[model samples]
Target: MVQNWSVFVSVSSFLLLLLLSKFILRKTRQHKSLPPSPPSYPIIGHLHLIKEPVHRVLQQLSYKYGPIFALQFGSCPILVISSPTAVEECFTKYDIIFANRPHLLFFKHINYNSTTIGSAPYGPHWRNLRGFTTLEIFSPTKLNTFLSIRQEEIRSLVKNLYSYSQQSFAKVEMKSRLSELSFNIIMRMVAGKGYFGAEVEDYEESRVFRRVIGEVFALGGASNPGDFLPPLQ
Candidate 1:
């Protein structure tokens, strides 16, 4: 009887949460002019409506709600645009309005308080970062100066591949090799030393660099539930 009562209480509490969230959502909607959105639940909102093959699901939603629509994922509101003209206009006319990236937990922790070029908000800092990259880092002269590093890395990769397949045909994991080449080139250019490839001088440093890079890439594109749910945050 006690176990059953506990379960009953839990269910009642969840129902209350749902009802309260629904009331809050309704009140907010009354004040703001949100884009056309499909029916959504209270707390979870359109999260439950999303399925695998995300693009196909989005295409179906577009068919139902038109080229541009809105979706609520927990407390976050998302705008979906499917029309080419709308996309062009967004990037051209209203680029500044939509320039900022969404604030995510991974970015906050891994990105030095979101001050890096990739995670910085759209403002004076972002503009300075853009200008720096354009003129200092990615400029044609800068790229040309790094040409020897790229050439050396590519040659080393070819030599390694040839050595592996010299005796007999060998299957190489191109993905990892390519990733190493890219990292090695970037490290050599930025730090004047390659942490990857045969030229690595310090194994410990290489291991740490590889580990950090792996973590950065792994968390970069991952979605945190805390980002959407304020209570979780």
Candidate 2:
């Protein structure tokens, strides 16, 4: 019993020491100079400064802080560049430094543990994913095979629009119809079926795919508290 207690205490002490070292290292690294930034609140940082029309808000901030400025959005440190020259420099001169993505939980859970191309860190694995996707999924030959599917979707969109227009100058909402057409077309090309709206080939698979897509969109739009607050995660 005494030996077990001693072992537990030793493990706890080691973990505490490791956490302390990590915090100290982070603070030490933060001494590196960053771009000009507005005053930020603790914990939430500059997240509250955001307002409607994100582009306009960014413009306002650029006007105040200069063309290039830093912002803390929750726990994330963002570098905003409004200047075309600066943006060009970042992508050209410093592309490799900025290639890595943050290790977000959404990427881990939704992206098969950051294995997906978009979420994966820049490395051999990411390069392979990109190569595979480009060659197999998005190659011209592959897309050419799906030409009929695209035409079918476009015809469906046109038919739906014409149906609405048959009556005296009816206001036809094309946005939803266009989106539906695009989704159906892509799904049909990829899976040989649709997962959303009409003409879904596999009902059970469509239901699952629809729910997954809905969840993905919702989670993408809604901020995760655990992202900013590590303790919550």
lDDT of 2 at 53: 82
User: Cα RMSD (Å) per model?
Assistant: 4.0, 5.1
TM-scores vs. true structure, each candidate: 0.83, 0.80
CA lDDT, every model vs. true structure: 0.88, 0.82
**What is the C-alpha lDDT profile of model 2 across 51-166, one tens digit per residue?**
78889999999999999888776667788999999889879999999899988889988899999998999999999999998998799998888889889888877777787788
Distance from true location, Cα of 104 in model 1, Å: 1.0
Clashing pairs in 2: none
Please give the range of 10 consecutive residues that has the lowest summed lDDT in model 2: 22-31
- After superposition, which runs of candidate 2 have C-alpha atoms over 4 Å from their true positions? 1-32, 51-54, 202-208
Cα lDDT tens digits, model 1, 1-233, are 99999999999999988878785767486536876888877678789988887999999999999999999888787999999999999999999888999888888898888898999999999899999999988999999999999999999999999999999999989999998999888888999999887778999998998898888888876778899887787
Q: Say which candidate scores most in lDDT.
A: 1
